[model samples]
Target: MFECFCCPVCGQALIRESQTLRCSAGHSFDIASGGYVNLWVTNRTHAGDSKGMVTARRRFLDSGAYGFLLNRLCSETAAFLRGRGEKDPLIVDAGCGEGYYTAGIAAYLRRQNIPATVAGVDISKAAVRAGAKRGEEVSLAVASLFKLPLCPASVDIVLSVFAPVCGAECARVLKPGGLLFIVSPGSRHLFGLKEILYDDPYENPPNTYYLPGFRQMRQFSEKREILVRGGQMNDLFAMTPYYWKTPADASARLAHLPTLSTPLDFHVDVYERCEDDAQEPPVCEHQTHNQ
Candidate 1:
């Protein structure tokens, strides 16, 4: 069903047979019992999220704290597809953790009567396994965002939310005029939480939205206040980069907090793949963060 997927080893098309995917070049990958495939060809032992982190993220997302963001993503993507009159489009959720947005976008497009194929890829087996258990009508793969396992010029849209951005890899997979949506944190994101965690809380710096072989189309930014309740606070904290670097004292401060009222700021940048192969020189460093 995932015609867009190619062999990571040989760069050849993959054909599914029973519980295995094999390419003509003799490279084969086994589909896990969770219904997700592992196409991560990495020599590095550790990559992506751990099981604990994935669980936290899944719980936090399922609580619907990020519902507004999800709705905006679906609306924008659906509108783009409708405007292009594309009845069937291939969408890839790069670094899709637990398939929350992937499945959501696919379902939304279906409700709008737009049949689309959605594929989710992450570098974490734990995350992809959890995603497969959801039984969404989308393909899930354990693969790197920097090195996708999709065919060249095979995807119509690529979505990245709080994930790493690999401009060269994205350009290779997208067809000319395809769209790439990058969702990053705005300057004031989580200001309240930062205030409690750091003695001198500072606003997030602006992002340099530069990508090779891509031209800026438009941007969508939103900020909203969210009340973190129950265990959601810890879950939210675990999904952010602060969890790794925050001092123990800061963490203890957060622990004593009964509830966290933080401003959630997100910026969605839409870029269109250039028709010509010409690309601008690299202008900015890529930022990597937890999803």
Candidate 2:
């Protein structure tokens, strides 16, 4: 399933022996006991969610608060895969946080009689570890979207949900005609929660992403009202970026609300990688040429 991984230093296909992933150049990475691996070369410089944030995210998601969107994502993505005509698909969850959506996609695909191997990559080691604990079906790795651990043109589908968009890297790793699923907040997303936090809250602006080799194929919008109670409210707030930005009075107001019927919106877009007339050459160490 992870035959796509290559050594960062030598660009040779990585082969696994026991718990170690090694390439022809002798560069090696050890798989963590938690069933994930760290392919991060310079992870310290990257900004990823902290352990507390992952804990909060896991708690909030486990509540099935986003079940509606999750179901839609699975159904729509599966339908796309069926239409794509790949018997076995390799699905990736880019920047997957704690693997809730990743597992959801995996389960859906499998239930629909479609065989798919789901892998996930997140910049956060904590996040990857949490995801590894969720299931054995997913191969979780700690890596940045900027430098994907997978080899060029190796994946069939890439899923980015509420994660940073690295269009170039995503395009680099996808095969020609590969599918890219991007999920983002819509205009009405979280307006209910925001209204309690400030005197005036604005609707979320439309999100946009530009991929060099990708063109939009289709899009789906999902909106629903979610009734969040006190504990779940705190869980939601603590897991969101708004938690840090909101003022003290806002926190007090959110704390006081026993229940808030908040509206959530998600925009899912499907893009297909276009064929390159002249594919870019792969960079490798110890460059070889015919003598």
**Decoy 2 TM-score against native:** 0.91
CA shift of 192, model 2, Å: 0.8
- Expressed as tens digits, the lDDT of each residue in 1-291 for candidate 1 is 565689999889999898889999899998877788889887887577899999999999998888899999999888888887765788999989888899889888878888888999998889888988877788899888877999999889999988888888888899888999999888888888899889998988777755878999998897789999768888999998899999999999999889999999998899999998866654433677433
TM-scores of all predicted structures? 0.95, 0.91
Task: Give stretches of model 2 more than 4 Å off.
Answer: 277-291
Worst 10 residues of 2 by lDDT: 282-291
Residue 284 CA displacement from its true place in model 1, Å:
10
Local lDDT at 122 for model 1: 91
lDDT of 1: 0.86
Candidate 2 clashes between residue pairs 3 or more apart in a chain or in different chains: none
- Give the per-residue lDDT digits (tens) of candidate 2, residues 136-226: 5787888877778888887899988888778777888888989888888888888888899878888777676656677899888888898
* Winning candidate number (lDDT): 1
